[model samples]
Every structure is written in C-alpha cells, then in structure tokens.
Target: MFSKACEYGIRAMIYIGQQSADFGRRVGLKDIAAEIDSPEAFTAKVLQGLVRQQLVTSVKGPTGGFELTPEQLRTVTLKQIVVAIDGPDILQGCALGLPQCSAKQPCPMHFQFLPIRDQLNELLRTHTIGELAGKVHDGLAFLKR
Candidate 1:
C-alpha cells in the first residue's frame, strides 16, 4: 500500500524515535539505515524529505545526527510521515487505479475498499511515533526481519 520510500521513512522514524526516547541519543543516517535494513543513499533521500517537512531534525557536527524532539515524538503521527514522504494522495487514491473513484463515480472495488481505507486513515491519524517506538523499545514489535 505504501511506496518503498514511505515504508522506509516510517521505519526510520520509528527507529529514530525509539533511540531518542529510550536511549536519549540522536541517530546517524548509517545507523538508521542499518537498523531499518535500508540503503544509506535511499534513506538519506527519505530523511531529506522528512527534514524538509520539519518532521525530523538534522544536525551537523562531530556528535551531530538526526533526531526528533520529545514533543515531535509524542505528536508526529504516521499520517504526517506518510504525507511527508508519499504525499496525501497515497491515503486517498483509488484502489482500482481509476481517475474518478469517488462515491458519485464508484469504481468496481470502491464500496468494498472504502471501509479498509477509512480504517487505515484512522490508524495512521491516531498512532504517533512515540507509541510505535515504545512497542519496539519494549520488544513487542520489530522493525527488522
């Protein structure tokens, strides 16, 4: 349902948030990529988009890296990250790839997919980075295979 970049972005955010909240440390791109099992270059691009959106903060120096403030970890929702990397259309796009798939012009799968899409949107809106990170930090979830 999500692009590779979006998937990686979500993983990267969760990992970064986990480190920042649990360990109280910033994460470098190389470490973030390794933890999420993504390529450094691609992760860099994804992180750049996130930084551009002000969803992630990038610092430069000997001890500098990437991190989210405590407020950001608590407030940044999955929907925000999705929209930042994949744009808002990913959540609203037609399941059948039709240009016009609204209720007025329903696609073949429109009705069947409506409930699923709404549920996904709600999940994204309600779950924050901190929540997911906590699950990982507590070993209740895994970011890697």
Candidate 2:
C-alpha cells in the first residue's frame, strides 16, 4: 500500500493531467488539493517531491503553480510518481515490516503479498498518467473524494 503522501501525489498528478488536458491551464496547489481532497499543506509538501523528481513542473510568480506538459503526462508512469514520493522501498520492502524478511525467510504474508506487489508494480509501470486522466476526462473513472 502507498503512504498517504504517495496516494495524494498520484491523485494530484492525475487531476493535474486531467485539468491540463481539459483547459490547458496550470494548476495551483489549492486547486490541486481541493480536487484530490487532500490537505493543502500536505499536498504542497508532496508536490515538492514531485517537482524535485521532475515528475511535475512548478513556477514561482503570481501565475505560478504546477503543470505537466502533454508529453510528460503521456509518459510519466505511476511507478515514477510512487518512487518519487514513497521511494523504491515500496517495491522491495518487507510486506510485514520485517527488516530481514525475504524469500529465504519469508513473512507469513510474504507469498500472498509478493504476487500482489508484483502485479501492482507491473500495472503502475504500464499505466501512464495520461491514460488514467483520460478515464476521468471521459467520465469513465474518477479520483475519490
């Protein structure tokens, strides 16, 4: 599972992509947080990581905020966003939080969780922000409130 920050970051990214595609507008942290139903402060912090990772772009002036270019929206995978916010530990950390858990000495939930994690990684890697945002744009999907 993703941390709240990671979850919010993903939703914010997808929402930004949707908004950009809809209106060709740059989005402010306030708008992004409202759309994603996250706290403004937390969303701002999460966005900083995204900006640092180059997963999203930001500006500083009065018209300043965040926006993803069309090419970026089309190519930025969930994996990149997740890694930016959550680190690669989501891919390799122990399912039960055991520091040493692994195939050699698996946790009780290890086998059950491994396949699910693998599938999640594959899905994240394959699905771009553009694809998910398209679903929102088309009314076929939504980000939870």
Leading candidate by lDDT? 1
**For candidate 2, lDDT tens digit of each residue in 20-119?**
8888889999989888899999999999989988998898999888888999888999999988888998887878888998889999999899998899
| Candidate 1 positional error at 69, Å | 0.6
Candidate 1: tens digits of C-alpha lDDT, residues 4-97: 9999999999999999998889899999999999999999999999999999899999899999899999999999999998888768989987
Per-structure clash totals for the candidates: 0, 0
Task: Give the number of colliding residue pairs in candidate 1.
Answer: 0
TM-score of each: 0.97, 0.93
RMSD of 2: 1.3
lDDT scores in order: 0.94, 0.91
User: In model 1, which runs have C-alpha deviations exceeding 4 angstroms?
Assistant: none
